[model samples]
Target chain A: AQSVAQPEDQVNVAEGNPLTVKCTYSVSGNPYLFWYVQYPNRGLQFLLKYITGDNLVKGSYGFEAEFNKSQTSFHLKKPSALVSDSALYFCAPPTNTGFQKLVFGTGTRLLVSP
Target chain B: GAGVSQTPSNKVTEKGKYVELRCDPISGHTALYWYRQSLGQGPEFLIYFQGTGAADDSGLPNDRFFAVRPEGSVSTLKIQRTERGDSAVYLCASGSGPSGANVLTFGAGSRLTVL
Candidate 1:
């Protein structure tokens, strides 16, 4: 039962404000975490990943995530929110089965108001 | 060619009918994967292919679902006796390596609606 959880169903932020979409994991050993975003009617696009190295990983579209081992969390964050950034985001961590299969979280919807 | 490509972007069919969704991975990619996404859920792993062989099919829900990667380039996911619950977007992704460290490139996905 290794899995990732997105506690929030939706997060709202005013444009130009900082925003955070939370994610937590339940897994053994050092985890490789990933974040993906899906716009309406489009497939998911990779945002960023944490494999090993700096806890702060930068991704596309000015998005970044901080991997916190103590809290077992890898939350997606942005310094300035944009209405264009609003979409569905998912937190994924690889399954322990030794395969490349990723176990994805339910997903969090981010909405930035103008 | 440019990226992971899927065919029949949308499909609507009656229950109990058979459906086939195809995927063509990026050139030179050795790993291919299939995932299903429901209305409000994240993409769920369905199968994984390493070259011409199926490295893992454990995520497939039942025997009704089957997939094949003939010649190690293209893949087709087949569903028999389709149920309404089977309606979801089937996504195909490809990676350059066999390890989880490789970032996957996903296709737009094939939306299947079982009536």
Candidate 2:
């Protein structure tokens, strides 16, 4: 089964500073990685995806992620974090072998200090 | 175009009571899915509907839980004899294609509370 792991339960970052949320995955075939964010009482919003392209993919709100095949990791990063960026982040892998499903991470709470 | 929408943002029902949650997928979406999310946990798949047929129902916990997308547009998830453990947010999502590569757009979930 395909799965995603986010080692950190929570990450606190100072506003205007760089921030990164790590994500790693285990899958059988070519991986389709995704990052989503959830604010209070809202649905999960798509941030970015790594289908097949340059290892670096940019997404909403100046957020970007690096897809490292060797490391099997897709880490979300931002050059300068904002207080409004604080929310729950989830990393998911889209599995296509036999079963077409997305395995989501446990979620990491991000706190940005002003 | 409008995004996926779910009805009854908050529902509180007594234990063992029947409950129904509705979802309206995006216009012309070919796939719809139902998932449940407990507090502090990620969403778990419950069922998936392709057009008017249920392509996958294996994720359903028991016979008490059933879902139908009669028109391939709107879907209803019904739960009979709901238990306290069933209390969670029920989320609905729709994507344009059946492939895992398709981006799924989700709705504001229906928060179900079994009292």
Candidate 3:
């Protein structure tokens, strides 16, 4: 079974500072990794994914993630955090046998202080 | 629908009662998925549909949980004898491909509360 682990339960960062949400994965035969964000009372929104490409993958809202096969990590990063960037972040691995199901991490709540 | 839509944004049911949650995936999306999100945990896979058939149901916790995706668009998840443990937000998602690499659009989710 493929799984993702987010060690941090909550991450606190000051506004305008760089932020990184750590994610590590375990799977068999090259796995797909993804990052999703959730605001209060909202669904998980797709942020970025690593399928097959460069280690640096970028997604919505000036966010980017680095996929490190050696480290078994795909940590989500942003150059500068915003107040609005505060939310719950998740790291997931492919859960679909063939139909795109996702197995997600416990999630890390990001708190950006203004 | 513009995005994956789940009905009854909030559902309140008594323990041991039965409840049904609905999901309407985006039109033209061939893959539909159901996930359960506990209070502090990330969403966990429940089942997935490739077209009108359940391609994978291995994530379903027990026999009390059942899902159907008739007509290949809308899906319904039926839970029998719901327990307090079953209380969580039920999420629905859809993707353009059957492969796990495809991006999925998720719904706001139906918050299931078992009293």
Candidate 4:
């Protein structure tokens, strides 16, 4: 079945340090990957997406994701972590079934300490 | 509106009762979708609507979960005989273009709790 996986349940980073939230997908064809963030009591907010373009894609709040086809990975990254960045991150990729439905990962919680 | 809007931010009810959640998509967005988010899990696709028709309902868990978009702008997700297991956050999102390339704007969501 086509799906996306977030290997880490939680990631911890100190303020001013770089951070990475890993995501890998298993799909039949080319995938359109997306990243969303959810703060406490808030809905998921779109961060970035990779359709067909350069491997690197940047998004809001200084967030970026690198789409690596060979590795079947699209990991979210930030150059410097902020305490405000602590939230739950999800990686979503289109499902094999025709339509716009997305298959989302379990999610990764990032904790940034000041 | 500037963003997708959902009503009844929180709802608590007894098991076996019925519930309805409403969603108002962003102006001019032709595609709307509904998803459910369980505790500690990612959002799961429930249904998708293209204009006034349901293009896909494969993600809906069962017949009891029904969604309708009559005018193609607002939608209502209705649950029949709600159960404790159905307690979750119902999310609504809207997109302007085709599925693969479209970026969805989501609402705050309606939280439902069944006792």
Worst 10 residues of 4 chain B by lDDT: B96-105
Candidate 1 wrong stretches, greater than 4 Å: none
Per-residue C-alpha lDDT of model 1 across residues A12-58, encoded as one tens digit per residue: 99999999999999988878889999999999999999999999999
* Model 1 chain A: lowest-lDDT 10 consecutive positions: A96-105
| Native contacts kept, each candidate | 0.73, 0.45, 0.96, 0.71
Stretches off by above 4 angstroms in model 3 are none
Write model 4 residue lDDT over A18-94, tens digit each, in one string: 99999998888788888999998998899999988899999999999999999999999999999999999999877
The collision pairs in model 2 are none
DockQ of 1: 0.79
lDDT of each: 0.94, 0.90, 0.91, 0.92
Model 1 iRMS (Å) reads: 0.9
Candidate 3 on A1-114: residue-level lDDT in tens? 788889999999999999999999888888899899999989999999999979999999999999999999999999999999999998888853554667777899999999
RMSD in angstroms, all models? Answer: 1.0, 1.2, 1.3, 1.1
Model 4 interface CAPRI class: medium
Model 2, range A75-110, lDDT digits (tens) per residue?
999999999999999999865643345656569999
Instruction: Estimate, for each residue in B1-115, the C-alpha lDDT of model 2 and write its tens digit.
Output: 4999999999999999999999999999989989898999987888888899998898899999999999889999999999999999999999887887788899999999999
TM-score of 4: 0.97
TM-scores vs. true structure, each candidate: 0.97, 0.97, 0.95, 0.97
Predicted structure with the largest TM-score when compared to the true one: 1
- Name the 10 consecutive residues with the lowest summed lDDT in model 2 chain A: A95-104
Q: Pick out the ten consecutive residues of candidate 1 chain B with the lowest summed lDDT.
A: B95-104
